[model samples]
Target: MSSVLITGASKGIGRAIAIELAGRGHRVIATARRPETLADLPVDQRLRLDVTDQESVDAAIREAGEIDVVVSNAGESVRAPLESVPLDEVARLFELNTLGALRVVQGVLPAMRERGSGRLVFVSSIQGRMVLPMIGPYGATKWALEALAETLAIETGHFGIQVSLVQPGAVSSGGGERAKVHLKDNDPYSALYQELPVLRGEVVTPEAVAATVADTIEQPEPPLRIPAGAPAKQVLEARKVAPEDKPFLAVPLNW
Candidate 1:
């Protein structure tokens, strides 16, 4: 079994993935900002890692030992229109979601390249491809992450390192509870903001996403990108054929 290291493993998708991989006999190293939060997980190791901090990332990588796979799942989201979102919050979102993933990648790539065999799985989102009201800030970070992951895929192919991007749609995680909403009392998009959750409809379970991650790791040659949930598949497929301006509008908003 492969030795897998996952970030943001205290809860949600990351936590689910850690549990799934461990159950499948993979040696899993789960890291969260607070190591105490991961104390109960049945994984090989629990580490305190804040991806935004390079020193923390490097130390965790070193401690984890030879990682066969690295899942860059540490991320956060903000709900706000581009114009209305606080600049500082937006910056923080980008720092955590976009650059944070990169930090982990930077820490692990050297050893992976030296071994000439490894997997780098990035947990992105369908929002990386399609944007909706109040999701601009979060979507922007995902978009940037997609670009970075895709570029890394190309650059690292020669080293026998595989890169996979796992995109899920409206996951039933605590993301909503943690999201920073920026809605002013008199904001023009107040109505839209109120309608956003309704429009999101049903969400996929975190276990579904974790299963996909495990499957990806098991594959000798997994796809470069995978839409982890049904909603993600529908949205991504629509984005491919639908008009650029209103892609996936016809796919029904139940997703």
Candidate 2:
């Protein structure tokens, strides 16, 4: 069994992935900001790790020696227009979603390169490729992440390390429930905001996403990117054929 380390494993997709891998007999090391939250998880180890902090990442990596697989699943989302979203909040999102993943990669790559065998899995979103209303800030981070993951795959292939990106559509994770939507009463995008609910289609479950991640790990040669659900796959296909001026709508009725 391979030793796997997953960041942000206390809840949502991260938590589900940890559980799935552990059930598959892998030695899973789960990390979250609060280790207590991971106390009951069926993992080999639970460490306090705040991906936004470099020191925390370094300490966690040092403690968990020789990881065979690293799942960069720590990320956050902000729902707001690019014009109205606070710069500070956008910065915070980038810090956690983009830079945080980079930090973890840096912390784990040295050992992986030395061993000449490892796998890096990044949990990105479909928004990484196609942007929607009110999710621009969050989408921008994923876009950057996709670029980073793809480049990392190219750079690390020679070192016997594989990189994979799992992009999921509107998953039924607590992220939607906890999302911070910012909009003034007379916002110009009010109509679009009203239509937002209709834009969201069937939600994929976290367990399903977890299964995809596990499958990716088990593959001797996994694809560079895997869209986790029907919604994601359909939207991505639409993006390829849809004109630049005519954006594809997520709502099935509109499609």
lDDT of 1 by residue, 29-147 (tens): 99999999999999999998999998898899989999999999998988888886899998998999999999999888999999999999999998888777678888899999999
Q: What are the clashing pairs of model 1?
A: none
**Model 2, stretches more than 4 Å misplaced?**
245-248, 251-255
Q: Would you estimate the TM-scores of all the predictions?
A: 0.96, 0.95
lDDT of 1 at 80: 84
Per-model lDDT: 0.89, 0.90
Query: How many angstroms is residue 41 displaced in model 2 relative to the true structure, after the best TM-score fit?
Result: 0.5
**Candidate 2 residue pairs in backbone clash:** none
Off by over 4 Å in 1: 245-255
